[model samples]
Target: MKPRPLDGITVISLEHAVAAPFASRQLADLGARVIKVERPGVGDFARAYDTRVKGEASHFVWTNRSKESLTLDLKNPDALAVLMDLLKNADVLLQNLAPGAAARMGLSFEALHEKHPRLIVCDISGYGDNGPYRD
Candidate 1:
């Protein structure tokens, strides 16, 4: 099989549940580095959606292989600072948050791009970022 085109990119994902996690994992399978950022204590909610696999959430293991997990509470100043430091080298930022969540945390594409001209941001939402249902 052909290696995927994103072989050298690094993806940082602020995601929960399913959609974004699935995509980011596929990226990692194809040689990308995926850093999954979750909140402290709770982690990704999907991790507890069920315990159907070896005492772990089936969804969690399936979409989180070959990736690094980091606990971050963006609302926390110290954590935000650490995340900002990481953006210094991130090639891509992938997020699937509730409406306006990214911007609320000051992690919007426009915000990050002002500093890193080459950083790519993909905002995943139940609805597209600016369509009906957008915040």
Candidate 2:
């Protein structure tokens, strides 16, 4: 069989709610290696949004299918170190965290550009990263 377009691509996704996860799922469908980063124990809050499908959140399943998941408490130094290590080799970094959250943690494009010059960073937010409504 022929290799898919994104066969060797790796995506690190720090996402929740809907948009980012859905986008990454599409990438995963196209054969990217999508590693979804979740909170240590609670995971994505959407997991509790519904249990309509035999005790599982249909939304979560739909948005997260075909991807690997990892638990990382970004607050922990070791966990942050691990994320940094992943970024060093990742092809894309996709996140939909609250505005400025990723930047505060130094995951912003400007922050990672010099080190991972080829890494593609995608930040999805309902509102733009700046302005009064960007919370």
Candidate 3:
């Protein structure tokens, strides 16, 4: 088999809907280990968007393929600690959470840089990090 460019890279994704998950799926396609962190219970809300594909949400299935899924309730300290531990070996952290949510959870670039200096942090937001429309 041909070697993939991202064979040794690992991506930890806290994402949903379309954009971020699709991006992570791309990384996974390139041979990265993409671990998708989803909310507990219902997982990504997009999973329930509609069951158009044999009892699965087409939107979620389209974007979330080729990745491993993990359920974590970030509001809980134990779950947060588990995520932080996972970051220890992750090469990238990708999130499309509401603006400031990741930072509030101590997953911001600034907050994590000290510990995971080599880890790349990607935050996807509709609006820029700061603006009247940011929410």
Judging by TM-score against the true structure, name the best candidate.
3
Error of 3 at 26 (Å): 1.0
Model 3 spans > 4 angstroms off = 131-133
Superposition TM-score, candidate 1 onto the true structure: 0.88
TM-score of 2: 0.93
User: What lDDT would each prediction earn against the true structure?
Assistant: 0.87, 0.94, 0.93
Q: Each model's TM-score?
A: 0.88, 0.93, 0.94
Which whole-number lDDT from 0 to 100 does residue 112 have in model 1? 82
* Each model's total of backbone clashes: 0, 0, 0
lDDT of 2 by residue, 42-113 (tens): 999999988997777999999999999999999898999999999988999999999888999999999999
Model 1, runs deviating above 4 Å: 1-4, 129-135
* Lowest-sum lDDT 10-residue window in model 2: 126-135
Residue 120, model 1: lDDT of 89
Give the TM-score (vs. native) of candidate 3.
Answer: 0.94
Candidate achieving higher lDDT, 1 or 3: 3
Q: Model 3, 1-135: lDDT tens per residue?
A: 899999999999999888799899999999999999999998999898889988789999989888999999999999999999999999999999998899999999999999999999999986777889786
